[model samples]
Each structure stands twice: as C-alpha cells, then as structure tokens.
Target: MINSDEILKKLAIESNIRQEEIPDIDLYMDQVIQLFDSKFMKSLRNEEEKVLTKTMINNYAKGKLFIPIKNKKYSKEHIMLISMIYQLKGALSINDIKAILAPVNERIEKENFDLESFYSTLIELQQKNINNITDQIKIQEHEIEMLENDDQLKQILFISALSNMSNAFRKAAEILVDDLLENNKKKGDK
Candidate 1:
C-alpha cells in the first residue's frame, strides 16, 4: 500500500507557478492554456488531468467569474484572476468565486488595485504558511502511521478520514465566505 506520507511528500515538492514566471505580455487563449499546463505538468496526475483548458476559460468568462478581456488577448491581471478562479473552482462553486472576487475585481476595474502587487503579497503570505501546511500533513501522516495495527484497513480508514475532513473544510469555508459577502454588502449599503 502506498503510504499517505509518500503522497504528502510528493505534493510538497511540487511547486506552484510563481508570479515571476508568468509572462508580462498579454497572451492568446492557447498560449495561456499551454503556459499553465506546462508549468504545472509535474504536479498533474496524468496528461488527461488538465491544469487549464480553453473550454474552462470560456466557461469562466461566460459565467462572469472572469473579468472582461482586453481585445482578443488576456492580460497579466486576467491571468492572475483566471489562475485564482482555477484553484478556487477545484473546491468551490462559481457563485462562491464570484462573491469572493467581486470586490477585488471592482477595485481592479476601477484602477485602484494592482494585480501583480496583490499576487506577490498573496504568494508571500502563502509561503509563510507553507511550514504550517507541511506540519499539518506530517501530523496526518503520524496519525495514519498510528493505525499500523489495523493492517489492510489502515488505508481505508485514512481515506475515509480524508473524505470527512474535506467535507468539514468545505462547509467551514462556505460559511465564512457567505459571511464575508454579507458583511461587504452591508458595508456597501451604507
């Protein structure tokens, strides 16, 4: 059986695409897809597990999760927005993303926000939290190891725990996101 620790180790080594790696110039649709896909290739489970796709991009725009495109190209800000949407969409709904990004998007469109700076700051904070993330994973691995007496049942119990934990995590995020949206709306009403 493949240990959960091994899996976590592999995930830790897989780095996400950094802001500096993103091209400064606006890119065509295909180029954008290729850039993300190639950069995230090592992290992908398989070729069929796409990092990004033209269809998904189009759907994001149609769903209003993405801001307006400039002419026929996607700017760096657009790239960052799309990237954020892509990650969020894995564990969140389109409505949730729309709610979360609405205020930030407004500031960007109003020329009061700088996407690059925002992205850099977010990256910095995320990096700061990496140790905590790794620590949590290690804690989980330790818990999994403690189940060694369960023999073949250990993996099943670990996976079930993961499922329950994911549901709990999602529920918490949904509630907090809804609360934030409500607070923002109340503030806007004033």
Candidate 2:
C-alpha cells in the first residue's frame, strides 16, 4: 500500500531535511520501475552475449534460467535481483549463481536482512576487497593477478549496483509513507 509522497515525507523528517530539498518521490518511483526495463535487457555482457546463443535462449525460455518472473516487464526488485545474476555470469555458473543467491532471496523475503545496514556493510566489504587486492600487488604477487583484478572489479560493480538499488527502494518507501501522512493531516483539518 506504500506510495511515493509518503516515502518522501518520511525521508525528509527522518533525515532532518527540508521537504523542498527532497526529490519528487512519484518521479523517483517511476524511475525505479523503469530502471529494470532498460537495464535488465542489457544484462548480457560482450562475453556473456555470446552465451545467449540459441541454445541458451531456449534454455532461458524453458526455465533453465529460473525465470521467477513471468512478465516481460519486471519490477525494481526483479531488476535488482537480475543485476546480481548478471554480475555473477562471468565468474560463476548459472547453477552456482542460483545457489549463491538462494540465501539472499530467503533473507530478503523473510525480512531477515536490514536493507540499510546491508548497503552500509556492502560498502565496507567492498573496501576490504580493494584492500586485499592492494596488499596482493604490494607483495609482488603476480600469481592469480588476473583473477584478483576480475574479482575486485566484479565486487566493486556488484556493490555499487546493490547500493543504488537499495537507495531506490528506500526512497520509494519513504515517499509512500510521507504521502499517507500528508493525506491524513489534510483529512484531519477537513
């Protein structure tokens, strides 16, 4: 039942931000939904693009890719999840990605994970991952250098995407809550 304006007001009050300073919550909501439509279609990278061969597309159609979503258009949540999948496409097998994301899906569904804290923790983890790469380079570790690079890059990109997705959801939620409060206030005055 959440909507955009309520989300905006909550964010404003919670963050001690002026109402005018907040972006348009409804517009943000639209952007969030559209984010998936534009982004998910571009899921396949140049290397992974080839993997979308006829057989692979057929496999996708046949549910080999675990199409939890049936509609051609997907929601922000769906896009966020798919983004994670795309990130793993290069490093992990399809089954492996599914296994890795299983716990995440469960956690999100069960509300076991705090979205805000998760985003913050991911940034810290990304920093740690970078530090590990730097330490390796400083030690003149040439072995697995390519792997280190790929790992670091993937971690950075994945965390960045996750952070953005979290923000989108948070903003949308805040706006929705704010709108409800405003409506209630107006009704009380009437």
lDDT of 1 by residue, 90-167 (tens): 678999998988878888888778878888887777677667656766666678777666756777766777778778
Which predicted model would earn the best lDDT?
Answer: 1
Residue-by-residue lDDT tens digits, candidate 2, 1-190: 2222332333221211122322343323344334433433333334343322335333433543433544444333443444445445644556555555555665766766653354445445645654554443333323333345676664554445445655675566456545655665687799
| Residue 38 C-alpha lDDT in model 2 | 43
Candidate 2 stretches with Cα past 4 Å from truth are 1-67, 109-120, 141-190
RMSD of 2: 18.7
- TM-score of each model, in listed order: 0.88, 0.36
